[model samples]
Each structure stands twice: as C-alpha cells, then as structure tokens.
Target chain A: MTIEEESGYRGKAEEFLQVFKKGAEFTQDLLRENERLRYRVLELENSLNSATAGSGPDSQSQALIQRISELEQEKKAILDRIQQIEDENQDFANRYVEIEAENNNLANLYIASYQLHSTLDFKEVLQIIMEIVINLIGAEEFALMLLDEKSGDLQAVACEGLDRDEVPPVKLGSGLIGQTLQSGESYFTDDLESYQRDILNPMVCVPLKIKDHVIGVLSIYKLLLQKDQFAQVDYELFTLLAGHAATAIFGARLYSDSERRLSTIQGFLDLLTK
Target chain B: MADYNILIVEDSPTMRQLISFALKRIRGVRIVEASDGVDGLKKISAEKFDMIFTDINMPVMDGLKLISLVRDEPNHKGVPIVVITTEGAQEDRQRALALGANDYITKPIQPNKILDVAKQLLKLA
Candidate 1:
C-alpha cells in the first residue's frame, strides 16, 4: 500500500522476467550446439561404414591375387611338361629316321642278292655274286673258291679287284677260307697278320652249303677297315648270300649237263641217219 | 557183315593216295581210286560201291556232275556220297548238301576226321 513498496515490487518482477529470457536464449544456443554435434557424429559413423566396405573389397582382391599366383604356378608346371614331351618326341623321331635308313639299305642288299641268284650260268652267277658282295659290303676285293667234291681241294673260280696271277688254289683244310669250308661255318678275321701273311687286311669268310654239305667258300677282303667292322649280322648276311650263290651254281651245273646230253643225243641221231 | 566198297574221285595223285591210305585203315572197307571224275564215273558204272568219297575240283569232270549222273542211275540212287574238298564257303556246303551229297568234309584232310565222318554217315558207329 505504499507507492515506494509497489515500485520495488515492480522492479523485482522486471528483473525476474529478464533472467527468464536469458535462460531461454541460453537453452536455445545449447540445443543448436547439441544438434551440430549429433550431425558430426553421424558423419563420422558414415565415414567408418564406407571405410569398412572398402576393406571388404581389399580382402576379396587379396584372395584373387592368391588364386592368380596359384594359377601361374600351375601354368608354369604345365609348360614344363609340354616342353619335356616335345623333347622326347624329337628324340624318337631322330631314332626312327636312323632305323628307316638302315632298313632301306638292308632291303636294297637283299634285292640285289636275289637278282644274282636267278642266273643259270655258272660263270655268270659267280661273277654276279662277287659283284653283289663287293657293292653291298663296300669291299674292294672278293673271291669265291669252290671245293672239289672228289679231291677236297678249293679252287678259286671268281675274283674281283685282284691281280690275275695273285690268286692261288689251296686245299680245303689249308688256309682260313679253306678251314671255313671244311667246318661248314663262317669265319671273320679283323687282324689278318694273326692268321697268315697272305691276308692283307680285315676279311670275312662264309661257307657255301647245299643240304648240310659244304660246297665252297666265299671270302671278302675289306680295304678300309674300322672298329666293330665285322659283326654277327654281317656273317649271317654273307652266309645267306653264299647259300643262294651255291644254289645258282648247282642249277647252272644241272642245266649245262642237260644241254650236253641233248647235244650228244642229236649227234648220235645224225650219225645213225648217215 | 558185307565188305563195303568205297569209290574215291580226285584229280591230284597225292590226294588220291592219301584218301586210299585212310580208307584202307578201316576194317571191312575196300577203296578203289580214280584220278578224274570221268574215270570215277566209269568205275562207278562197272562196280556196285557202298559209298563214295569225292573231291569238288577235278580235271575231266567235276564232282557235282558225277553226283548228278550217279543220282539219275537207278542202282546208284540213295548211295551215300561224301564230298571231301578244300572248299569251306557256306554257299559251297549248302549247294553240295542240296545235290544229294550225304556229308561234306574240308581239307587238309586228317585221317581220323575222315574216318569219323565216314562211320557216322554209313551208320557204322
């Protein structure tokens, strides 16, 4: 009820209003700062999620890199196996070519021997056999000595690359070739000086047989000799050639005897008509 | 009980000799040889043979012709004719059986095999 007391109450009321307004402004500022902080936190969480997603791709890439490395190793191993197979194939091809060449040479030799065997003339057959031996075996000198059935002496019937008077007849049991004839087998001499002085170089001798009987001997002398020159294969080939030559010789003898008998019969008929 | 006569018709002397040699080994069997089909037919006409062993390939006359001729004859009808030859084709076997041949045997001939065939066809076993 006093004016002074009323004025004091109004001032207190005004001061209270001013304090409430300041408090509300402070609360609004605090709320704005809290919203900004919340936004920043959300941004950080998004960044973390993005980084985690990027790491997943990196792990997958690492796995792919490991698989690539394994594949490269496998590829390298396959390449090595292919290289080995190619090398083996090349080696086999080389061996096959060498064998084919040798087979061709043997076929040629056999064909030549067969051609020599078809002759029915004794001298011509002997000449063909000597020529075939010289050509096939690469021999410089060759001689065919026939054994006389009654006397058991070997006489040289054909000769190639030798002096006309140099060849000499010998007994069936005398020299190396003669001994081969007597034994009805083959003999090879790599060192000629060990056996006799007459043999000049390496030589091979094969006995000619007709139904288990020794008929003659075929001797071939090598002028150009090498190590492992005379093998069992060579002896077998020479023996077969000698056998064919003996058959030819026998056939030639039969043909000549038949011709002689026909001529003698014709002559007797002419004498009877006269 | 009775001596059975076998007539062999073949072109080859060696084959004829071989067949005759086999037939001689059988008891109560007598074998007569002929070099060709013509000679075989002549021998068949002259004698009454119990059986016939013939070859397909011959010089003068073939075995089929001889078989037909023997079949036409009244006395030689129903006589057991056995063809022993080197022909092994199915057509040859069928044709031979169709031509009144009792049996067919192929060569190179074994003596025991021939004897077995002969015994079976003649009802001797």
Candidate 2:
C-alpha cells in the first residue's frame, strides 16, 4: 500500500514543474518583444523630429521671422521720410507768409508814389503833399518850406499842427532845416523816442530835391504817438517823396499858372471877338 | 464778385485811397468812399451798406454823430461800424464806441491789421 501511493504523488509533482517552466519562458519572450518595440518607436520619433527641423516647419518659421524684421525696418524708413516731407512743407508755408507781407509793403510804396503825381491843381497838390506827410511819414507836426530865391531864406508854404506865425523864416545854412537844404540829404533825430513837439527844432528833415538840387525842405517836428521809430519802408518813402514830391509840386505850380494865363488869354480873345 | 458793400468815410482823399487799398484784400468786398460824415450819412441813406469805416475827426458832422444817426435807422441797426482814430485820441475812440461803433482802429494802421478787423467784422473767411 505505501509503494503505490508514493509513485502517484511523484508523477503529479513532475507535471506541475513542466507547467511552471512554460509560464517562465512565455514571460521572458514578452519582455524581449517589448524592449524591441520601444527602440523602434524611439527611432521613428527621432526621424520625424529631424525631418521637420531640416526643411519643413522650422525653415518656414525662420523665413517668416526674417520677413517680419525686414518689414519693420522698411516701415521705419518710410515713416522717417514722411516726417522730413512734413517739415519741408511747414518751412515753405512760413516762407510764403513772409513773402506776402513783403509784397504788401511794396504795394504801399507804389500807391504812395502813384497818388503823389495824379493831380495838376495847386490846391490838390498841396493837399496830397500834406496827406503824404501825415499818413506816410506818420508826422503829427510838420511843415513844407520852399526856398526864397531872392531873399536866400526858407519860408513855410504849408504848415500843420502849428500856426503860420509859429514858423519863422530860416536862413540858408543857418539851422537844421537850412543845413538839410544845403546838403540835400535827409536828417533824422538821433533818438526818436525822446523827440517832442518843437516848432523850431524838427525831429526829421527831408530835403525836396530835383537831381541833387534842393528846392524845398520837409520838416517833421513831431511824429505820431504810435510811431516810436522809423520803419525800413519809411526811408524808402522819404527818398521817393524827395524826388517825386518836388517834381509834382513844381509841375503843378507851372500848370496852375499856365491854366490861369490860358483863361486870361481866352477872356481877351472873347473880348476882341465881341 | 462783390458781395459786401463797405463805406469808408474819410476827409483826406489819400486816406480814403489807402483804406480802400487795404480793404480790397478781402474777398467779395465792394468799397464805397465818402468825403465826410455828412457824405457818409447821405450814402448810407441812399444804399444798403454792410459795414462802415469812419474817421473820428471828419468834417461836417462827426463820426460819432453819423454812427448814432445810422443806428437810429431800423434798416441799419445790424450794420457794423469801425472807427479810425489817432493813437492819442483814446477818448474819441471811447466816445465813438459809446455812440454805437463796433470797433476801433488807430491811425498809422497796417494793411494786415485793417484786413483782420474787416474780416472779423464782416465774417469773411
């Protein structure tokens, strides 16, 4: 009875060992296959990374970045150019305004000269001269004096802001007015701000000349309250008046005398015909 | 291209011409000259003027009187008046303003100044 039972137990133990060996072998094969598959997956991932970095996405992105940088530079340069053009335009606009002001001053001179010679009547000529003095010269007190050929003295023919008696006869080469007439050059005060109303001593004296020959003198005793100093155009006006006013006055006097003689001759003719 | 009629009342012909030359810078402005306040009044009565520039020391009726008379007329109630006065005559300027002058400009005026006053008063561009 003991021998048979021991033999059965030994056969069963051998069958169990065979099953355990088969299970261990299958586990080892699975581990080996897993390791090989892991390596394959790593290789595929690296190839994909290299392919993308070599020529596809990375290069495209780099080109796009370079293009953006270039565009930014171009935009900055364009903006700079635009700013320069704007500055130039502003300069031109300012110059245009300056020119416009200069043009107006020239027009004033032209108008003054044109008006001075527009009349032939003696009263009208005198009135024009007075207006030229007050408006153009900005003189509040002034006198226009003509030289007396026989007496060798200057007598005021037209006086403003003063009575005729206030202006006495000035001997040639005696006072400021006489010196202005003698030299045939303009005389201006040293300091216009300190000028006051003086009938004897004038602030400015412009000799009326015809080709370097002084015929009369324009004496300005006081300027207007608004006029502190002479402007650049005022000197031009003085020069113009010196020549034009003298010629205009002389021409007007001659025309007036001739007109009166013509009237007298016409009257005599009428009387003879009658 | 005359749209506005402006009257300039001045005693001196040269002053009138100068004022006219200055006023001509304004676009669409027609200028009318008058010798004195009396003549200005006559012209104002005869025609419809948009504005008036007058001297303070004009002969044959002062500018203040002319302004008052012009303001008395209902048709001229809206008309603007600018007085031209000497720089020293501040009292005259004030009197003119009190008598219905809209503004005042001193003598020895610049053409640009005259244009500015006229453009502002006339509402011109």
Candidate 3:
C-alpha cells in the first residue's frame, strides 16, 4: 500500500485503540465498585437472617439482594466486553506495525528514485548511483560499469569498497556480468559457479537498458552485515533502476559530448571576436 | 581571447574536474577551486575573480549564503555569478537568481552553455 493509504488506516487504528483503552478503563472501574458491593452483600445477608428469625425481614434487605444480583450480571457483561476489545486492540497494533514497516520501505524507494534523477551531470550521476547503491541497497562493495558500445566491453566507471585496479574490462559475452548483459538477463550470486564467484561475491548484476539495449551494468559485490541476503524488495528496486538509471547515464554521456563540441565552437568564436 | 579568472565552488572532486576541464577548453581562462560555501567565501574575499560558479547543499555553509555574502561586498557588486544546482530544485534556482546570481543551470551542466553565459556576462564574444 502507498504511504497515504497506510496513514489513513493508522489514524483509524489509533482511534480504535483509544476507544478500547477507555472501555477497558471503564470496566476496571466497575470491577472495583462490584467488589465493594459484594462486601456490602455480606452485611445485608447477615442482617436478613436476624430480621427473618425475628419473624419479619425488612423490604430494604430484600431490595438490596435484588440490586446485588443485577450488578453481578452487569459486571459479567462488562468483563466480556473488555476482553473482546483488548483482543481487537492487540490485533490492530500488530497490523499497524506491519504498515509502519511497509511505509518505511516505500519512503526509502521514493528517496532513491528522487536522487537517481537529481542531476544530469555525468560525474554527479555516477556519484548519485554510488550513493543509492550504498545507502539504499545496503551494499558495501559495488561497481558502476558502462558498456563501451563501440568495443562491446564492460569497463568499470565507478567503484566503492573495492580495488579499482582489480576491475578488469569484460568483453560482451564473457563470464557473469557480461554474459547477463549480452542476454538481457539479471544474474544473482545464488546461481553463480564456484570459480566464477571469486570476484563480485554474493553479487547481483542488473543490466542498464535503454530502448531494450543494455548499455551498462550495476553490480553489487558485498552486502552489509545487517542484511543476510537480498529480499524481494531489492529485486523490485533492481528492476526499477535498470531502465531509469541506464537512461539517465546515457543522457549524461550525450550531454557531455555536446558540451565538449560547444566549448570548442565557443572558443573558436571568442578567438575570432578578439 | 579575454583572459578571465573564474572560481568554481563545488563539493565533489569529479564535478570540479569536469567544470575545470571544460573551462580549460577556452583560451586564457584561469580557474580556482573551492570545496564549499565557506571556502568559496574565503576565496572571494582573498582575490578578485572575473566570475563565480557555485553549487548548493555543501558542508559548513551553502551556495545561497555565499551569493548573498558576495553581493553584500563593496568591491564585488555586479560581478556575474552562475549557480549549478540539482535538476528538481526550481525553488532554489529562483531564490538564487533573486539573490543576485546572474544565471543558473541545472546539472549535468552543459559546458558550452556556461561559456555562453560567461561570454554575455563579461561582454566577450
């Protein structure tokens, strides 16, 4: 559910909690009064025996017994209502906790999405992609590699928590990352061969596709200590970023290219003017 | 070509490199770099610059304060200032322009566009 929808349910749950809490409090108060009445019943019964043995019971004593029985019935009903409301409140509290967790995840997704498109600057896009991987995905070691379209090679553009010198360029149809990108498939570490898994351990390589053509790869190397394994939500995020991130990075590359040409022309124009 | 001294104020090394590299494509332009607004303010006070390019959301101080502070200086009035900011930050862009920033561009900065504005502001070709 969306955050807005969850918040609406949360409001109703809070109101429900308050009403049940009030009902429980009211029932407790009645229980205290009922206990006091039961003690008073003992006194009335003692007096009734005396009056009955003396050949006439006061109407007030008989009336007191009837009132005690009525209060007993009311107390039983109140106790049942309190128990039912308490159970419902407990269930509501659990559901609210679940919604809270979902809301937090959704918020994380929103922030990541916002940051991904925050800039079109080539260098800035690289930084943002790194931040999104580290902060949002909880990956300590990750690499952002761009596909050299002309050479059909995967070259590491940016990396974190790993050695840059160790990142060898991969040809289009090579092992792991390259193979997945060539086939337009996502590769998870669980399906990796033992020898092929030495590098990018426990990694997920998502292809950056624009117009269904894979342009780059976002490879997550090592996960954070807190995260044992990737979750369903991580897969969803991977799917989201594959297209959006690739498109942005491609645009940045094109922008930078135009920028270089413009600078040359502008410089030439300025020299002529001078 | 007019020899111009430009100050690039940004937090990222890569962004600084990109801007500096682009500026170098033109002739007779000297570029100085500062990491954030506080450093930018210090440099602005220390030396004369033909133009200033700054970014928002930095540690210590921010671009908005830097622009206002630079505008408040006696000898720095009417100098051209360009703001490099995030794409979705229109409110900030408008605010910077209102605060006497001469022009603004969203990132990724098209280098030629910056050169164009620089030429107009400095009355070059």
Candidate 4:
C-alpha cells in the first residue's frame, strides 16, 4: 500500500473509533433513563401504598390510580427497551467469546492491550493484567516476576496461588523464567508430565518486553481447576503481555519514581527548616 | 402499614449486600439473608417470611430447586418468590417462574427495579 492509502486507512479507523466511543456514551444515557423510569415507577407505586378499595372511590385516589397504571405501562416500555439493549450487549459478549475461541485472537490482543495500558496506577495496571490472565486466559498458580537489572535475578513482584514468601528469587538464565528473560520471547509448555519433576518449570512463561529487550516474565504455573487446557486466546494474551505489559509497567514505574522524588524533596525542605 | 419479612438467598456477599441495600429503602420490609439455597430452605422451614428473593447460581442448591421446594411446602403455598438471574440465563428464569416464582430480575441488580417489583408484588397485592 502507498503512504497516501495508509493515511486514508488511518483516518477511517479513527472515525470508527470515535463512532464507538459515541455509542458507549449513548448506552450510558439509555442506562440512566432506564434508572429514572424505574425510580418514577417505584415512586408511583409507593404513593399507592395506602390505597384500599373501601377508600379508593375518592377523586384524588382515582387520579392516583390512573397515574399508577400509566406509570406502570411506561415502566414496562422502558424495561422492554432496556432488556433489548442488554440483549444486544449480551450478544456482543457472546460473539466476543466465540471469536476468542475460534479465530478472534487479534481482537483479543487489542482488548488485552487496551485494558493493560488503560491505567497509569502501577497497582491497578498489575491488577488488570492479573484479571486478564485469570478471566480471559483461564489460568491459576501464576507468578509475575520483574527482572532485577543490577542483581541479575527475577524478583516476585505480584502473585496468586503461590505464596510470595515461598517464592525465592530466581537467578538470570537459570530456568524457564530465566530463559524467557534471556531470549525475550514467550515460552509455553503444556507438557504436564515433564513439568511434574521440574518444580521451577512454569507451564507457560511470557517475557514482558520493551521493544526487543525483555523486562519481566509472567509465569503461569498451571491451568485452573475448571479449565482443562489452554486455548488460542491465551497465547494471544501472552503475546499482548509480551508487548503492552512492558509499556504499562514502565509508565507506572516512572510515575512512582516521580512521586517518590517529590516526597523526598518535601522531606528535605522540612528537615532543613527544622 | 403491614410489615413484610423478606428472605434473601444468595452466595455472593456483594450481591446479597446489593439486594439488601435495595430492599432496605422500601418501608415495612424486614430482610433476612441466607448464603445458599440450602440455608434458604432451612430458613424457609424454620421461620415465616412474607417473600423470598433468591439468586439462581449457588454451591449446594440453586434457585430453581429452592423455588420448587418452596412451592411444594404446604405452609408457604401463596408466598411471593422472586428469581434473580444472570443475563444469559433466560431459560433458568423461565424455569424458576414455571416452578412458581412470582417475578424475575436480572443481575447487575438495579435498585429501582428491585424496589418497584417488590412493591408491586409484595405490597398491597
């Protein structure tokens, strides 16, 4: 494709992105309207709490009764609309699942990338990565380790299933995690039989990379009890983590460093004054 | 105003809290919570509740079974039962209604929906 055609394609993509963002906003509005109608109906119903057939024939009570019925009908219509929108959302989620199962790896990759880097907070970003692995990848017994550049070891930074205290820092170029760090590539082995003997052999190891350089490794120790085996989406998520996770980690780390520097400066000012 | 005793049967603490929170806004409601269907059934047998709000998916027994058992009980024949279900499980909701649930609500449970439905079904009906 020519550069001109590439720019045109990029323009179309941006238009589509804006359209979807607008659609999300519209969905939010519908949700709010649905909530308002719901409250309206509830208020109308609560107003009739004192109504009984013995005292119901009065003009004011008759008006309340008519208004209650009208509100009920209106509520029904609003609920129907809400249900339709919810059905569409459910359909989209179902299709997403199907694509994740069949051949929607690219979409999965995009979503994983979007979610991982969507936050600037380091802890939240790590939490999102962990959720993606557990919810999307269907894995358990995982440890996310960052490479200690000066010490040449992998330190356990975030973990689940495996106790953080029990996990010793692994030497660089020692095992599967080390191998992924050195190679700057993802390595996944479903060889359950072989992994039984090698305690350090993670069933899956994806190196977090900044460009070609490996920064950290997410080691999946095993599949969860409910999940029998890994699927195509898991590998795509691994690839996404390999690329986008590094950027998010670096961004968060940079923010934390700046915050720490500011705190240190404030401390120095206070100490000098004292 | 007559007092209404409502039993909430759900395993997830967050969901139970949400349901309780929504129900508490209405006047004349006394809410009791059971973590699972088994616990709900035991409560149903031991005490008298004006209404039952149950979630479908639980560890020991589900809402359908709870609904069936509640319907089967001679004492609780006319009690109002509401089925709380996930979005994808329309079939289960239908089954619960068939098993004699008075109404249904989908999850990400809306506060107003619960309030309106509870008022419509449980109060002055």
Candidate 5:
C-alpha cells in the first residue's frame, strides 16, 4: 500500500480502538452503578426490617404504659373514694360528739329537776337552783331573791360567792335585779359598772314570773375581763336555766305552805277531841 | 405396617375434641389423644406412634417440650412432629424446627389442611 493509504487505515484502527475503549468504560460504569443500586436496595430492606423490629418493642411498651396509666387512674379514683369516706366519717364523728354533749346536759338537767321534787325547803331548792344555773351557764356566781309583793321590797333568798351583808336589801324599782322584777322581763348587761355604781363586770337579771306575776328574780354575774367572751348564746342559756329555777322554787314554796296548813288543821282537830 | 400412627397433643378442650373428630374421619389412620406434653410422653411410651401433631401452648407441658422429649426417644429418632399454634413468627418457626419439629401449622386449624399435611408427611398421595 501507499504511505498515505496506510496512514489513513492506521487512523481508522485507532478510532475503532478508542470507541471500544469508551464502550468498555461505559459498561464498567453501568456495572458499578448496578452494584451500587443493589447495595442500596439491600440496605433499605435491612433498615425497614430493623425499623419494624424496633417498632415492635416501642408499641409493646406504649401499650404497657397505657395499661399502667389506666391502672393508676383507677388507683386515684379509689384513693378519692377513700378520702370521701374519711370525710364522711369525720362528719359523723363531729355530729356524735355534739349529740353526746347535748345528752349529758339533758341528763344533768333531769337530775336537778328530780332533786327539786324531793325538797320542800326553800334553802334546799335555792341551793339546787344555784348549782343548776352555774353548771348550765358555766357562770362564776348566781343569786336568787324574792320580792315582798305587799311591801314592794326585794329580799335575797339565795346568794352564791357573795356576802349577804354586802348585797343591799333592794326595792322593786331600785336596783338591776329590782328593775328586772318591776319590768317582769329578762335583762342582760355586759358591764354592770355601765348600769350600776356598786356592781362591776357583766351581769344577767331574769325576772321569775308565774302566771304574769313577777314573784322573784335570778341574777348571774361574771367578771368581764374579756367582754367579748359573753355572747348571746350565754344569755339564752342563762334565761333557760333561770326559767327552770323559777318553776322549781315556786313549786317547793307551794308544797311547804300546803304542809303547814295540813299540820295546823291536825293540831286543831287534836285539841277539839281533847 | 401402617404409614403412621399420629398422636394429637393439645390442652384446649375444644381444639382437642375437634382434632380427634377430624382424625377419625381419615381412613387407615391410627390416632391417639393427649391433653398435654406429659400425657403425650406417657402415650408415646406406651405405644409406637409414627407422627405427633401437637399444639405449642398447653397446660401441663408445651409442644416444644414434647418435641424435644420425643426427639430424644430411641424409637422416635427420625419420626416427623408437627407443631400447630396461633404463632406465625419466623423466629417461632425457626425455633420449632430447631427443636426437631418437622413442620408448623398456624391455627384456625382447617381439617382439610391438617389432613393434607398428614398425607404429605406420611407420603400417602
């Protein structure tokens, strides 16, 4: 062959060899990409399996926690129920204490009234009255004085923690007790010094009336070191005890007068028979 | 000799009864019933049962224990044992196989399916 023709042929062979080299490189690149894709797919599958495996425990734990929370709520409800029961128990206990106290007071009052039935002497009746009044009102001192209705004068019948000489012989319209008798109504004074020159501290004077007639007066006195300590409840309780005293004293007097009249009649009959 | 004498070991009263009923329907079958693995072992000691169909969860002892015990027995060295249970996990299947269980069947046990497995294991058809 000629030199030019031979050079052209060699150039064509070189061009073919370059194309074959490019094709081989492209095939190798494709194989490498295919291998990468296969590896990536395997990794994805493994990750999916691992994720599912991991989620299993998470779901189980969540379910367990949910069950535990439900149990805890039930426990809280039980605790609340127990607390409510305790509150009810406390309420019942307080009511029981109050009822017990009232029962004791009624028992004491019954005993005092029973003693009045056995006694006809005014002194004995007065002593019982003072005891009942002091216990009922929880007072420091108490006094009962009767009025001579004909002379319009008051005479002290029973005095507790006070000297008979110190207490003046009061008229119907003169002192605090006398004023109560005259008014025929109950009167309460927080400070005796506010109402009277001689008397000191808080005092209560209740007139003893039988059938609209003021027969006597009952007076309870307490030193007002703390004035607020005396309340309306104290006044109400004292008035109730005074009413019991009035009934007892009047009944005893009536019984004694009847006994005296019977004795006198018996003595007269004995003389007549002689 | 007969192809297989199958032992059905299960604890559930209903499942055991159902399996017994199904086994009776198949011809040329010698069937034995056991309530649990302990009863199954007793039954196995008394007779030469060819195959064992057992449930995984039972009262006295489980199917896994029965499988392991039966595998250790001299006469049942290569005898096929089938586990039937509600568990379908691959790990459970692998474990049953590892414990010498030849095959596993999941429940709501169809009678025809159990029969098919029995025929295949015994090489009846």
Candidate 6:
C-alpha cells in the first residue's frame, strides 16, 4: 500500500462529512421555519373564527325575525277578518233586497183591499171587481157567474175579454168552476206555461162565498200575456176578494133593490097626492 | 208646493192609484192623474209637466198618438215620457219609442221599477 494514496482518501472522506453536516443544518432550519409558519396560520384562523362569532346572527336580528313572523301572522288574520266582513255585507244586501220585495207585495195587498170596498153601487162594485181581476189578479179573460139557486146553474153576469154570450151557463157540480163553487174552495192550475183555454178547465176558479155559502164563481180562463204564474200577493188578493167581494156584492144588491122599492113607493105616494 | 209635477195617464183607477202611491215615496213630488190620453193632452196643454207616465192601451187616444202629439209641441218636446206596455207588446213599446217616448215600463209593474224610471228621468238621487 502507498502512503500518498491513503492520505488522499482520508482528506476526501473529511470533506464529504463536512458537506453532510451542512445539509443536516439546512434541513433543521427549514423544519423550524415550516413549524413557525404553521403556528402563525393556526393563530390567524382562530382570530377569524372569533371575529365571525362576534359579528354574525346577533340577538337583535333574532328578535327582528320573530317580530316579522308575528307581523305576517297578524296580516293573514286581518285579511281573513276582512273577507268575513265582506261575506256578511253581501248577505245583508241580499236580505235588504228580499225585504224590499216583501214590502212591495204587502203594499199591493193593502191597495187591493182598500179599493175593493170603496163603493156600494151594483155597477160600481162590478166595475171594481173587474178592475181587481185585471190589475191585481192579472186575469185577461174572466167571468163572474152567479148561481141560480132554483135552476142549479151558474149564469155569467159580467165578463172581461169575452162577450157575455160567449160564457155559457155552468151547471152546478159539473165542471171545475161549478165544482169550486159547490165545494166553496178555490181551484188553481199549478203549471200555466202550457195552459190552453178550456171552458171546463179554467186557469183559476175562485168561489165567492159568505160564511161557507157560495153564491158565485169567478172563472179565469186566461191570464195577462205577461203573467204566466200567480204571485204570493195574488193569492192574498183572492182570499180578500172571497169574503169582502161577496159582502160588498150582496150589500150592493140589497141596496139596489131597496132603492127601487123606495122609488116605487114614492111614485105611489105622488099619484095619491095628485 | 212640489219640486216636480208628474202626470199619470191611465184608464184604470186602480193603476192610477198604484202609480200615485209609488210616486208619493219620492220627496217633494206632485202627481196628477188623467183617465185617458185625451184628458192627459188637455192637462199637458194647460200646464208644464216634468214627467209623464202613460198607458199604451188608453181609450180615446193611444199613448203612441199622445207621445207624437206631445212631441209636436215645442214646449213639451223636452218633457220626459214613460210608457207602460204589456209584457208581450214589444211592437207597442218600439212604436212608443219611435214616437218619442223616453222610456217604457212593462205591465205588472213593480213600484221600485217605476221609481227607478222616475229618478232617472228627473236626475234625482
């Protein structure tokens, strides 16, 4: 072995050892720098968390949210209340209209009753009955038939929308009108839309009665063109006419007979005096 | 004294009474009745009327003829005339309108309808 060769190998080994030591020192410095940077990043994250906790979702905002929710509920309740009031108002309006109609019907009944007994003359009573039939009952074709007690037949005394001769005598208990008079009950057709005039089958037959003693029958063959059906007030008028008309007619007839007798007596007295 | 003077021309006393009764509901209004169109025309000639309600089937003179005659007069041309027609008498209603009737109410009249017509014609509240 040569000494020079051994010495050169030993110097190269020392230089290699120095370079390894320097590399270890640089690795240690880099690890220290990395640990310091990691701690600094952790501190900054913790501060950010603290700042967010301080600023977000405070007590005032929670109260405001609850208040807003309550306000929404209150608004909904108010809207519901308004709707209820509107429904009630609509009902009241409808009721008002109905009441008005009823009032008018009552007024019509009052007027009809007042006019029926406004006169006592035979002709005037008949005229009033005709008017009542035309205006109140809305009868276009009708006849007032008085029963001939001895003959057992009803003879038409007055007629409207028809000639007096056109209305033939109705026998007792024969047709609708006669039956109504015999029974002392009124007869009315339920459906008048398809009604066709038949003398035996009248649209309406009201018996003129005085305490269950029927004297005549008011036969309605046809109604006014506008009146296809009778109203509630019409039935009321019929009821009124049944009693008041009978009394009025009977009184008028008695008055007429008495007047005629009085005139005859006056004439006799005048002849005796002359 | 009345604020308005209205006339009703009808043959039936019942109808005249009904119309008068309805008209009485209005405040400060006077109602005058005539039995026929001829009588109505005489009254109209004598006095100025605010409104007139007439039946179409009146005797002596029909409502259409009366409306035409009233329109012929210079003073009564502006007066409002309302005709009462039967439900099926559309021809009569049209003729009345053509003859210068302002409006028409049907027979079997509701008093409210009459008042509505009166209010509209008189521009009342």
Full-model lDDT for every candidate: 0.72, 0.87, 0.78, 0.79, 0.71, 0.88
Backbone clashes in model 3, listed as residue pairs: A120-B107, A120-B108, A121-B108
Clashing pairs in 1: none
Task: Estimate, for each residue in A94-127, the C-alpha lDDT of model 4 and write its tens digit.
Answer: 9986753453355445556777777889998887
Off by over 4 Å in 4: A1-107, A190-198, A267-274, B1-125
Q: In terms of lDDT, which candidate is stronger, 4 or 6?
A: 6
Kindly list the per-residue Cα lDDT of model 3 for residues A158-271, writing each as its tens digit: 988787766778787777787867888888876422323345333688998986799988877766545566666577778868877887798888999999999999999999
lDDT of 1: 0.72
- Residue pairs clashing in model 2 are none
Indicate which candidate wins on TM-score: 2
lDDT, residue A206, model 4: 90
lDDT of 1 by residue, B1-125 (tens): 44888999977544565566557657889888987889999999898988998887678898888888889888889999998654334566576778899997765344456777778877887
Residue-by-residue lDDT tens digits, candidate 1, A1-274: 8999999999999999999999999999999999999999999999999888777777989999999999999999999999999999999999997775455345434554565565677777776676456434445566777887677787778876676356676676677776787788777775753543254222677777787787788776643232225444355457667677778788887888998999999999999999
CAPRI category for model 3: incorrect
DockQ of each: 0.01, 0.57, 0.03, 0.02, 0.00, 0.41
lDDT of 5 by residue, A1-274 (tens): 9999999999999999999999999999999999999999999999999889877877989999999999999999999999999999999999997775454444344554565455777777776666545433444455677877677777777776676565666786777777887788787765555544344221678787775677788776653222335434455545554566667778888888899999999999999999
Candidate 2 CAPRI assessment class: medium
Q: TM-score for each prediction?
A: 0.51, 0.82, 0.49, 0.45, 0.47, 0.79
lDDT of 3 by residue, B16-97 (tens): 6556655765678999999999999999899888899898767898999999999998768878999987555788989999
| DockQ of the two-chain complex in candidate 6 | 0.41
Report the candidate with higher TM-score, 1 versus 3.
1
After best superposition, candidate 5 residue A63: deviation in angstroms?
Answer: 2.5
Residue B5 CA displacement from its true place in model 1, Å: 72
Q: Clash pairs of candidate 4?
A: none
In terms of lDDT, model 5 sits at 0.71
Which CAPRI level is candidate 1? incorrect
lDDT of 2 by residue, A1-274 (tens): 5988999888888998899999899999999999999999999999999887787977889899999999999999999999999999999999999887776677667777888889988778878888877876688889999888899899999988888788989987878898998899899989988777666578889999899888899999887889888888788889888999999888998898899999999999999999
lDDT at residue A90 of model 5 (Cα atoms): 100
Cα deviation of A165 in candidate 4 (Å)?
Answer: 2.4
